[model samples]
Target: MTGCQGELVGQEVSLYIEDNEGNVIKDEIVTTQDNGFIDLWLPRDHLYRVTIKQGDLSAESEISTFEGDNTCITDMQLL
Candidate 1:
């Protein structure tokens, strides 16, 4: 839901999210939907660190949910 801006339909990946202060938010395994996306609800007005993993490949990015910030984040690339 937060990274890998490409078609990865039905792929299962590990998700790890944390606040800027190092508070853990989400850490679990999730599957991508048919649209190559996942659904997540995050608190507003804070910056977060997002990491996604699929096997040995992984991606990481920084995201925010503040007002006027982009909600749909899809720019991380799995390496």
Candidate 2:
């Protein structure tokens, strides 16, 4: 599995993980580090969607499906 990260300096972004039934399982407000990056972890046997927002700039990652313990990294660029 592969995931992505977003880059936003001194800005607050929201992260959410949803199940296949469109129910929110986890959500949080994350601030990017000095490098403008954040790490995320998702559970197995579930589908997830990730979104990053900073001010008027926001981007969403494609729906990702996980089946086992694995690590995925993705990068989102705020426009």
Candidate 3:
């Protein structure tokens, strides 16, 4: 996540993708590096509840990717 001046370097980030039933379909936990960036590969063509957490801050959103397509999510700036 980016901060006021620049990217929040070397921070812990957690990502969780859950199904409709609230069961975790894919879980990814990693530390951000080189301009607060992390990469994750998730299953395609399915609805998922995406949860992102860092420290006491967090955010959630729903998304579905096209089959066999890779997605990139930008503009996650931490206030």
TM-score of each: 0.88, 0.65, 0.69
Over 4 Å off, model 2: 1-7, 63-70
User: Over the stretch 1-79, how does candidate 1's per-residue lDDT look in tens digits?
Assistant: 4445458889999999999999999999999998788888899999999999998999999999999999777677779
Best candidate, lDDT: 1
Task: Give candidate 1 misplaced runs (Cα > 4 Å).
Answer: 1-5
Computed on alpha carbons, the lDDT of every model, listed in order, comes to 0.89, 0.65, 0.70
Predicted structure 3: lDDT = 0.70
**Candidate 1: how many backbone clashes?**
0
Q: Put down candidate 3 lDDT per residue, 1-79, tens digits, no spaces.
A: 7333326677877878897668897677778766667666666677778787887877787766777544767555553
On the 0 to 100 scale, the lDDT of residue 57 in model 3 is 79
* Residue 75's lDDT in candidate 2: 49
Total clashes, candidate 2? 8
C-alpha lDDT (0 to 100) for residue 21 of candidate 1 = 100
**lDDT per residue, candidate 2, 17-49, as tens digits?**
667688887688887767567766665566666
- In candidate 1 the C-alpha lDDT for residue 72 amounts to 77
- Candidate 3, residue 23: CA error in Å? 2.5
Prediction 1 TM-score vs. true: 0.88
